[model samples]
Target: MRALRYLALAGLLATAGIAVAAPATYQLDPTHTMVLFSWNHFGFSNPSADLNNVQGTLVYDEKDPSKSSVDVTLPLSGLDTFVPKLDEHLKSADFLDATKYPNITFKSTKVSAAGKGKLKVTGDLTVHGVTKPVTLDVTVNKVGDHPMLKVPAVGFDATATLKRSDFGVGAYVPNVSDEIKVRITTEGHAEKK
Candidate 1:
């Protein structure tokens, strides 16, 4: 009976000693990320758009998947529509108004597991001083060691739809595509704790 009790205690200790995997927290490397947008000018014609100088961080737990989230912030002054005159127009009060509102940010409040590396991210997106609830359908591309940086990296693709008009970008809406389709592919590096 004494031997059996000792064995049971040893087994319990072994079970309790099981190690948990480490969580990953990565800082968005803007040079490795792309922020692209496409919209229709008329009914079916496509017009392209892009933004730069995006800065943020993404935190995720691969072992414990529930502990994952993202926070992305982009400068309004970084708005680049390609066309020289159009870029100025976008920064005016009728649109993003770069002078008044310096940054547009998306902060994730919850991350839900959608199965098989897919996640549903719900967050508060603040743009042009208007805050709104936004949901991003996200896919975790991979989490591994990056050969170049010699650091652990996390890759993911995210998509979200925004109504420009709702954010006070109502000018020329019918002419300038009311629905904006955004795609973000980010590769971020995790720092050593």
Candidate 2:
């Protein structure tokens, strides 16, 4: 009986240790993260834009994916569509009105395993002073030590689609394409807890 108790205690301790190491919080590495958006330009061609600034905190639970969470902030001022004139126009009052609504944010409400190495993240997205629910399909590319940064890191590829009219961003809807497809590739470094 004594030996069995000792063994059980050891097993409990080991499980606790594993749980402690399983969950890690990573700070978004802005330099390694990119958010790109694409929309059909009058059904002639798809024009894409890039959002340069992004910062967020991601709590990843490898063992239990349901425990994972994320909160992200994106600045509207980082809009860059390659075309200088169009970029300026996007930031003006006619479109995004970056001066009025300078920031976009997302807070995860639920995180669940979609499939092998994939996560379905449902969250609230706030943009242009409007908040709406958004769902993202995220695939984990890799989760381990980063060679360049020499730190624990996680890389992910995620995609989401949002309607411009839903967020009050209906500038040239239907013509410029109301549906915006967003693609994000991010590599975040784990922060020391």
lDDT tens digits by residue: candidate 2, 71-162? 99999878889899989988888878889999889999999999899999999999889999999999999999988767899989999999
Q: Assess the local accuracy of residue 151 in candidate 1 as a C-alpha lDDT between 0 and 100.
A: 93
TM-score of every model? 0.87, 0.89
RMSD of each: 2.6, 2.7
lDDT by candidate, in order shown? 0.85, 0.90
lDDT (10s digit) by residue, model 1, range 60-112: 98766668778889986677778879788778898888899989898989888
Q: Give candidate 2's whole-model lDDT.
A: 0.90
Error of 1 at 34 (Å): 1.4
Cα displacement (angstroms), candidate 2, residue 130, comes to: 0.4
Query: What TM-score does prediction 2 earn?
Result: 0.89
